[model samples]
Target: MNKSILRVAPMVLSTALCTTAFAYTVQGTVTSKADGKAIADASVSLLQKGKSAKTDQDGKFTIHEDEQDTTSTGIHNQQAVGFVNLSQGVLHYSQSSGPVQVKVFDLMGNLVSSKTLYGTGSVDLRQGINAKGTYFAKVHVGSATQNIKFTTDGNASAYSTSKTKSALLKAGDTDKLQVIADGYDTLNVTLNNLDTTLALSLEKSIPPEPTYKFGYALKNTPTPSKGCGTNTTLKTDKKVENGEHHVVNVNGTNREYFITLPTNYDNTKQYKLLIALHCYGSSAEDFVHHTPDYDHPTPYYGQQVLDKNGDYIFASLQAVGGLWNKGQEDHDFFGKALTTIEDNYCIDTSRVFITGFSYGAMFSYSLAQDYQDRVRAAATYAVADYNIWLPQEKGMDKNLPIAWMNVHGVNDDRCTFDKAKNSALPRMLKKNGKASDGDSQFTDASSEILQENQGSTGHLCYDFKNVDERFPIKFCTWPGGHQWTAHDTGNMSVGWNWESTWVPEEVHKFFEQF
Candidate 1:
């Protein structure tokens, strides 16, 4: 979370000089208006004395002799420089002597907030750093020569081992804080209640950045809406049920699916098509309720609620084989299911999307690759990026340029977050692009980070833009189990946490881009 500090206290100036025919110099002391404390070594110049005097440790100084009626002097102090631990939300930029500008951007490329400081002081960031992801702040003075970046993230709840949020802290409670500086490795600090005077040595960069590799090759930027298939091409029965099952026969095998129209379906408008695939051991009916959140239904279902202005038609389809990514029958499921929706609904040929969990999630990746022309984008949860099990026959489509998003939990033994982030995405990202790629360049992947943790759940979000032009793939994680993490709204942060399991809502929001 980003915070603003608002406070301004003027500096006190006073001078005393002997006034006599032979008197020439003056003396003065400079004090800070903020704490009424004397500021040592402040520069003071007396015009009458035609000389300058520096304030001593006691904020006292004497000037040389010059003919004058009174000692008249002007004082100037050096710009204050220091770091403020933002966890407390008290801001120092507001109290800066020179002009300053602050801007914050979230990992997903969303600009959280920006402020320009002339002389205001301090801001409260109680909601800013509370389990949010790594935020990048650009702090600059009137000149661009000394601009700097601040990386801030932490879970206040984690400050205390106690599970109870209230037990985390209270006014007057004292605790030792540990910080690592540039040259020095570590330092232990003790702070009091509202201890605003704390300062520490800073490095060229407070948060060191990760090194990035460049070079990429992408086919073209894929739009969210308008893929390969259209209503005019997939000729099938137009009439369909909103909830009950609908079957389409392929080679004598009856394929079953459930179609749910948007809440306000209009023939004149084409809606985005969503193919919801169930995880292992789950059926089409089960999938209708599995998406967004496993415990409750989402706006994806017209019978449930209307989301995004009722602009999407959902087709919940079942895998022909017991397992997806198994064979040809299982392999061709998306093409058939998507074509069925194209035949029946007024859908934008380009905005066709797929989302699934577990094995279904893996299948969504395969589907996007095999049918790149039809499926523009996809989102999968409880699955890792490089965890593909494509049969030998379907492996040839390995290098497809597609826009994708994934959500997995670190606690998921089945699909580990570390392996996916550290192994899968990196490898797949390189494979998905050639060394010479888009205008964004391979080295400049977005790499936005949003880190949040509530209790035992740690939510992390990362984005890699221009994996292919306009085809930014984003990855998000939370401290969760193998199954869907239950909605932990009470513990989540309003700054960026999800209402019903952050993954589900974010997935829906991701597809909305198309």
Candidate 2:
């Protein structure tokens, strides 16, 4: 978890300069703000009286001021320079704000280097020996600042340890560094042993509002309407009959989620299962609204609850951060949800599926990659491409033998379909061991429509269908951008008639074919 250190008692600034009698050394580490992970290549420095010392790869620094041994040198009694440490993360650029700033000052209150960095980039300082005094350093990004103060006695060699392993960390682990520079607040950082990755970025303040808010009590939400009969009512008890909405503890946090029973559900019947993920700021009900046929039709059914005809049960879960696990400790929350569903329902062990929309779709993609043994297939909507957050597959060796399908809109403003062609298709083809000779480039036609002319361009079937040797990953693009087109809506509906010009029906047929 990323945490912001709200406040700390400022380090007492001392004019007390380092003399030849005092040992002068300073050490620390740098890390990512997203997840408190450490970063490498960050530069640490100690500055005094117009002099500075650069930190080694380990983010450690040593500053010495005097080479001549003299009893009179001890009488200088003035701290001259300040200390500055800087590091950023891989995803540091994701922030709306630009680069982070680093500032250094001498013990006599003279300013030195003031540099700004875009990423967890590191830089060395210039302070050296024969400079006896204290120094001040500050790190600033936007309105946030962290400060630090240090003193150096010119005696021992000032060794830099940028790449050296810190005694504070085990051989393979990183350490956290606390920094407060000239003009900013304190920045608590985690530096990794390898210094190649960053976990997260966080401010010292409380986290912002969650992306999703459940309004089960409100209409137009995903909850079953009152007219859907006793089983569909929000107040329906779990123990009385077959119903959704189970309350369970996720890592000790109480949460309620909806479960879909198979149409053939019987007390004695066991079935396969599927986990459905929701997008950011969305709920389990959102999927149902998108797939209205999952609900029994009114009027003719007359308040009778509809049973799912599919052989698998569906579970819609709520996440702590308005999303499925995002490579954080809260990932345990997703694991907890899985156990809750398996414990409460008669789920088949060998046939679990995962799917979602937007954020949910990304989660589904992540689960398929990470939990390959647990999931047999994955289907995602509105996810056209992959990135550092949701990386695309690499090769057949990396494929998990799980079926994959993605629904994307060409005009999607959030995730363009064309952007996904390189990463997504390569991974998919490598999994299936199938490749196409034609150009794999896909052009973004519009927000709602994308056309791949290199291969087959048609309404229903794509050009490279089922070409991979492992489980085939399929891509479906709509002409519109970021919208559920008539085709997508058809696929979301039930009993979609492929011959009736209903696009949703074709989508159902597509899923049923597997």
Candidate 3:
């Protein structure tokens, strides 16, 4: 994954300079401000002169600068230049001042190869070298010379002089300096004179915050009332019972739902609430009890894990017409159901979660966006941004970040993985503060990789870097087709077996994080 670097704007600081032309040395120690610890291996660069140095074990680095006359020397004018392509083992040179003598030397100071190229050409450095290691190329043009260090591993170190640690700058010249390191913000400084020892402290970078709550109130702003706490009445059309269907009237339309309370339930104890949405043509009862295969019992998508933990309240909601049309009516029904549950149960307002599969996953994505402040996180499988209608135009804040985890089959046909990869995942990643150009392990071009991992055995999951820490976004891909718990039997067809299902366990682990 590609990491994002925060670059600070250059700020010039004035310093006293001597009138006489003399070389000056700038030395500095880089340290972390968070714990007052030395930061070793940090890169300090003179951007204008293309000179840089790495801090030693003690976090100390010295850059020696010599004042030079640019007009008298061809080196400063760059009349002759060499480009080293380490991967191809070639050194390309361009010289305007006659023939150039190029010599390659190994790290042990043994001469490897020598060649003479005129005007512009390339020399094959691999001709006389067989071992893979660091080598240096010395190019002499007229009275100027250049040394380039390269490795067989496709890395070319910067151009250097005979001293290797020294760089050139005109007297009283202004130059931009930069310092970069991991887990810290990039620092930029401009200086006019050098001959001094300095101590530089790097500030630790702050982790990203959830975008979904950018302009919203605190997550725990909702409080229990009505049937909660001292109030004993469970607000509903019927008494709350495990595996029993209940009704809630939304906009004069009755919607069906079922609740599964922990065996050791307490009216006063606050518990995490998880709402499970059923896929198209699947009812709430079928989702909870219908077994995928005859060999084992129903998994109920994390219900087993929840029952083992015994601190969670699980509820499954049914869609009218056996389909989520992605309309306003379903959105309103969800809102009413959530309000009714929170009003009646002693619920932890900050730990509410939602999950589903297929069309159900589509609605879960919609609800995650519409109820960003109310819902803590969402985990789904075989989800797509298209095909099913989403409440994008419901006037909800789209900038808010929600901790999201999605599992999709690269070979899914009903709700294709292309829609999720191209639209859904990118939107969530962007809202969570990830860079658009950053590298990702999950890509539309990874069909071969996805195919290799296809089966009931294993899958690939990528946790995006540089995203909001509080609301992380994870994308996982499996090898089977559009099924709740995908099972591949080596024919690229969906197979069913309760023991082979991994979705429920993965979802349980994700929700347990909060």
Candidate 4:
């Protein structure tokens, strides 16, 4: 753990003394529903502006916001559809205008039920519609349509989030909503008008995906089985092996994952674990093995050496049902998968790292934000967090902080690099005491500009250093499209394709510091 937490004591004292006692603030403690225990490090913020405060060791926190600072200029993604009356088996939703059309679909994109509501009412899954697994509820009001995805356990079902529109609440008036995640009880939150606590939660709801994999083969069957169970409710049983095609069951649904090991692996040795997430519509194995996407000249992974001794462990994870960090089940899937890896590997806890492409890249931030203690550092390529999610706490742990690096393309059309570097990254920096709107002192530190792809791309890197001199943030933006920059790092490479700006050696170097 970083002992720098001791150095921050003075700063904490200074902040408390500087703030006027009369300033308006909201104080409360956030506790988990599963156990009435204080949820340490939970975010207590004015949900709209993202002005947040971290809970103390006891889960108690005080958040202050200027009374005049309250404003909601954006439409909330998932509107608070009232409470879920589990006993009645009815979920109430609010529609500004009625005579609405509501439709329910399974994860396979097949419509299970449809209805036309004259006004805000309920979706009765209690009727012939209730089976386990994840479901999508589509509500069409007038010309406006809203789709809310939820998970259930067969007996009862509820959406993962609840939110009230910005226009409905008063600036100083406080309101509370209950978030009913499947397999978890409601997470009731007290929200001040300007702060959008629940608003951010609903944005995570997912639509659906075409393919699904869990524990290697068909649904919940053990390995070595071809044709398996018939039910579509997400569920699985898995085993970890080379090219095992593992499946992690979340909320009774089977989510898929894959793993790759270094050549010289030993259980007694401590090794770094790199969790590589694939881009949307991509395979888990392609990034793990060289599928011939390297540049003619020197390339990041495609051309780099592939046969290095097992210095680290590399695991590639396929998104659950083709979704990554988009829903409650996805979050559960990530944590469960990580637990699966740790139980099986002799991982060096201090060096657990992650990197992703596009959608995977965007979700990496969430992994670091939510699992900071385990995720030492993160790097990415392409679009990151199109819908920027604020941190629940400054760092998952103030002392055990995780670093981030971004590698994107300037001329790329898929995900703009400027938006990530100039916009999203700074917001992330703000969480680390980058004063709001303050000019940052990032050095123009681009290194080993690929010797092969010369003049074709603008390769540059920016480093954000911390108090301990452990560079936590590195930004590598090049003149290319959405691609991973894997290059030759003396030792063997982690197999790469042509669309790269850096190498596996460089990537390992960036993370070795943690």
lDDT of 3 by residue, 195-245 (tens): 557789899986554333132223434334344465535444554324556
User: Total clashing residue pairs per candidate?
Assistant: 34, 80, 4, 27
TM-score of 2: 0.40
Say which prediction, candidate 1 or candidate 3, comes out ahead on lDDT. 3
TM-score of each: 0.47, 0.40, 0.51, 0.43
Q: Model 4: which ten-residue window has the lowest total lDDT?
A: 1-10
Error of 2 at 424 (Å): 2.6
Q: Which ten contiguous residues of candidate 3 have the minimum total lDDT?
A: 4-13
Error of 1 at 106 (Å): 65
Best candidate (score: lDDT): 3
Best prediction by TM-score: 3
Local accuracy of candidate 2 as per-residue lDDT tens digits, 69-181: 22232222233122223222111211123555656666434676676666434454333434655554444434334433344454333422222111110112123444433
lDDT of 3 at 384: 78
Q: Which stretches of candidate 4 lie over 4 Å from their true place?
A: 1-242, 294-307, 388-400, 433-458, 465-468, 486-503
lDDT of 3: 0.64
Ranking by TM-score: 3, 1, 4, 2
Off by over 4 Å in 2: 1-243, 288-310, 329-331, 384-399, 434-460, 463-470, 485-507
